[model samples]
Target: MAWFSDAYHFEKSQLTVAHVTDCHLFKDQSGEYFGVNTAEYFARCLAAIAEHQVDCVVFGGDLTQDHSRDSYQLFAKLIADSPLLCPVFWLPGNHDELQEYHAIAGPHILSHKRITFQGGQLLLANSKGATPAGWVKQAHLEELSKGVDDTPSVVFCHHNPLPINGYLDKHLLENGPQLLNALVNTHHCIALFHGHVHHDYKYAFRGLNIYATPASSIQFTKQTTQWQQEDLGPAFRLITLNFDDTHSVQLTTDVVWLNG
Candidate 1:
């Protein structure tokens, strides 16, 4: 990860969000990714988040390890059985089949939408492109940028727009610089959140804060040039957004590690 956190953030908020990403699930419920049962871990994650009274949940993509229809079906079933009562939103990751995922997914995935909360709204940028690397079309970028203005806002996607200077750096969003510039230009943008690096990362560019939530499946080693996984449990990011009548938002973040 390119950034650091000296201490955990806060304890209370108006709009609380749980961001779960990089599930890498399989068709079989007992499937594992590097010894971690992806499906079970994801279920554990949802169970843990259910305790928090979150206003919404954002699945940051890569729902399937094998990109199979059965995998997506399992994903749909899990959420259907999940105790989480909040609104759910999702986007495509590098491994996600952008072209066929919608049809293949038993429960149709929603189109690009916003998660509106008390103070402002959350925008999703589709960074899924031609390969493992990310690419957002100029038209879509412009559309996403238009939503952020004087109102406090946050952006979510699947790829890290900036590199973490590790093996994942090679898979950084291809046109990420432009994407960053688009969001940066939105002075009211509060932060950008994503997954794909498989590690918790925090970054700031041109005053726009960014974060990468840990995967619900496996955790990756940070700051290493080589590929590696850490002995860690399934996890997700808890974002507490406190807003004022002035339409500005204050955010505090914490990652909830499950006992999987």
Candidate 2:
């Protein structure tokens, strides 16, 4: 972790968080998706994350491809075996069953949708819908309003809250405008993090940074009419929150690719 600090700004009281998403692990360890070995790739990503020694880690969803109890158990075991010495948080993706996740995830999982640090708050919402698409319900928005305060915050969910174009747009969050309205009302949010896109992306929505991380298992090609995999390998985002003299926090993000 100290070895990697030179690549990014480090300040006193700064919180470093590693974000990994869309592992898409299958029940069988040897299972391959689109000619890529997902489980092996995910393992390598975890090994890379361990080197960062982050304060905490967040799994941004799509934790499983088979949606089986075995898959979640395997995921738990992998994390347990890893060298990450911090709290772990996770949410459900479209492929996941919330109830099953709750049962397997146990206590480390966030019961409420928010976590507060000395400098800022981390808010999470469930966006998975009945179909493959997603929706941030009105109730979720209300919850977000209650959780957010004066502190700069980052919101995390499984689906992209804004459209990115091409075939992916068809499966975007259905009530994205409503979700954005809710976020706008918060007023203190600095960024929004999500998965499901399976590629690295950064954009701004109403002055807030919207970041989408590449999947831990595979990378997706952008601006395609149909699903396609990029030749690149797995990656994760390293986020740092540094406070200024006025106690205001500044957020910075860096993407770490396992194979380049």
Candidate 3:
């Protein structure tokens, strides 16, 4: 429940961040999951991200499929060998084990949980609890509440704080209402980002924008009552935060598909 503060000043008018999630990587590069070659797709997504010139990269979780030490090692190696060239921060998704991920990506881990860029801050909280579903601990909520200040901020977590309907809703954050209530009271949070649904989604709740990025390996069929895969290729999100003269921040997000 400690907040790690890493602050940086950017001269640019806007800060560019690449959001990649749900990699579901395996130890073997050739291993496939749900008919998708996750390692291959993740590599392609990383290549796409390299071209963006992002200031930083934020991983929205589900970093592994097998939850093995090798899986975490492979992920760390891929990122180390990639050309993204920026600070990478990651949170654990439902499919990920924190200890295993932290053991490998210790330096790059998002456990410190907050990053400052220009006039805005990106606050990441762990929503993974004792179950596959999401739950925000009271300590995390208190940390978030205390972290808010005059700067505009966006929160990132592994689970959707709000339901997306169908099968996904069943596993949505059980205490999402409490989380939302805490956020709404902050008055400085502009948006929220999450993974796990494996599909792209955008909505507004209590005046805060809620975004869900597609999985880097596979996408789930939307509006389905049961588990099903979508035919869509892997994708990632590029988010740009612009600051006005009043220090008000505006965000624009674009989902990039790696089909080629």
Candidate 4:
């Protein structure tokens, strides 16, 4: 449902984002991930996102798995062919190639690392470190500090800041605490949303709220200590944002699971 306060506030102060992630698409159109068709699954995700009427869409990362240039192009093609009309923003994942993402020419896709709204600023930080584990560069940290002004804000990245399980935790963001202390916790960030863990999770770290979104392509079994995959339904997140009397933003987020 849309936010309602007064008509003007309702119209101007509300923002809804469709957060999708971890498609893991390969170069070939028929490529599948352990029997799951990543491209088809991504198409389903785009259709699901279209239903939300979001102001914008954020592809939280892991856009490709094979690390091929063609894979990234196919991702762009899928977005161009999808029903989503809102601006699309993305960041690179551990499996993605940075140069190809920078070279992509498309519609609706934005090169913006930061977007400002009447409610607050939305900062997209690149957490693609040297390894599978996440690390934000010194420059990104500087951007995060500058973008996160006195205005209330939210953060998006490709890596989870906290450990989730034995298998997933093995690749957890290497300097997660440093990231939290430097930008997320120190600034006026209400919540930090991420997707590398591939499970729906919520955590409170030093009074900051961090949320993880399930993958648009697949979900690893969350209860496992070892690596395991569930052929379960895929899901995305619908984040609704509204500003309060003090100009601080309040967000209501729900996970939308796609039908099998």
Candidate 5:
């Protein structure tokens, strides 16, 4: 609805990004899906976001257990109650329905989008498709390459392009190599961010930073080909970006654990 209000105070020259992922929120807090209180956990994560107070918030998809329209409405209302400076940006995960999300979030909720903020650019690529794992279709790749063609950019999506050290990696973006190739060949992306791994991880891909934020509901421990679920509590990533003409860009990622 583009409800701009004095409540949203933002500094035009710089931006702070808060990233939360894999909420898997449900309608009922007591509803146990995979043995986690999805709704309560998501509420706690939202509270954490309210406390951090960043310029913009990014939800790395799988926002709901199932792609329910009611779920999206609930999410919109939850975020609307927050006083964040910038509008929330959403990327679809394997669990989201792109059409429903667009209907709920608005026309701006495209599968992929290029956003400019504080002299820097962000390219959000949609990885939602019919694939059981992940898919970066040709059209989205082309669109992403175009967005990063000559700008310093950070990429966002739902699937990790790098190895996650588990069976889940099998569902990793099947076409990640092609996507990364497009990014590297285009010379525009400085970093790539994603979810679905449900853990905090960082790796270097073709000289670009590839990072994954932990789930906001529950975290999965890192193991070598082993699946271990832990009550690591809810987590989020608060990232501050500093840019200047003479100095290399500076970035910091802080893990914030929700208390409750």
Candidate 6:
């Protein structure tokens, strides 16, 4: 898990985005684990975001602990109840069901399309259905490759294209090379964001910035001898983009402690 300060610089723009992922929301109101309620922690995380004024929100994936319609309903309601005025963009997680999530979460969830017309271009690609690992379809890649201009483009998905030093590293996108091969070939994209490792990570690949946000509920210690979820600290990310004919991006780490 790694975090970088002032990761990138962009032109001045009022557009700000909050990135939250892997909520793993559950149906039980008790929000309990081993008979102890965990709902308080969930509430705390949501409440903490009220302090930030963002133009949009991006949920990277893993929206439910159990892939149930009820869980998606709760997640939808949670967003509706928030005081945020920003639009939301969602990508699927390994835990999410595409048909059910789209039915319940509405049209904000993205897949194989360019979603924004203002500030810059935001693209959401589907990479959740690959076996042995996640994948980006060739047709989708072809569309995505041509979608953005020299303007800064931020793409979101559920699978990480880069490998981290841990258990999940092996489970990364099965066709990452193909996807990245297209991305680099495009020469217009600024960064790629995703979730699934439940850890904060960023790596530069051939000039493209690839990043993954930590889980909002819990974080897993990476490259450890034994697999365990530790409080690397619950957190989110803030992305502000500045663009024109050419583009640049800035990412800030927002850490929200469950105790507060």
The numbered model that scores best in TM-score is: 3
Summed backbone clashes in each candidate are: 0, 0, 0, 0, 0, 1
Residue 159 error for model 3, in Å? Answer: 0.5
Against the unseen true structure, what C-alpha lDDT does each candidate score?
0.80, 0.77, 0.82, 0.81, 0.72, 0.67
Q: Considering summed lDDT, which 10 consecutive residues are worst modelled in model 1?
A: 1-10
Better of 1 and 5 by lDDT: 1
Using lDDT as the measure, the top candidate is 3
TM-score of 5: 0.87
- Runs of candidate 2 with Cα error greater than 4 angstroms are 1-12, 106-112
Model 5: residues with Cα > 4 Å off, grouped in runs: 1-11, 82-85, 106-112
TM for candidate 2 is 0.90
Q: Which stretches of candidate 3 lie over 4 Å from their true place?
A: 5-13, 106-111
- Candidate 4 weakest lDDT stretch, 10 residues: 1-10
True-structure RMSD, every candidate: 6.6, 6.2, 1.8, 5.5, 4.6, 6.4
Q: Report lDDT (Cα) of residue 102, candidate 2.
A: 72
Cα lDDT tens digits for candidate 1, 1-260: 00111112223337788899999999999998999899988988888888997767788999999888889888878877888776566778988875545554333234435766566777777888888988988878877777665667788989888888878889889888798888888787889999998878888888888898989988889889898998588999999888766656888898888753
TM-score, cand. 3: 0.94
Q: Between prediction 2 and prediction 6, which has the larger TM-score?
A: 2
TM-score of each: 0.89, 0.90, 0.94, 0.92, 0.87, 0.82
Model 5 residue 48 CA deviation in Å: 1.7
User: Over the stretch 158-239, how does candidate 2's per-residue lDDT look in tens digits?
Assistant: 8888888746677788987777767878888888899898888888878878899889887777888687787478899999
Poorly placed runs, candidate 4 (over 4 Å): 1-11, 184-187
Model 1 alpha-carbon drift over 4 Å, by segment: 1-13, 98-112
| Model 1 lDDT, residue 117, Cα | 59
lDDT, model 4: 0.81
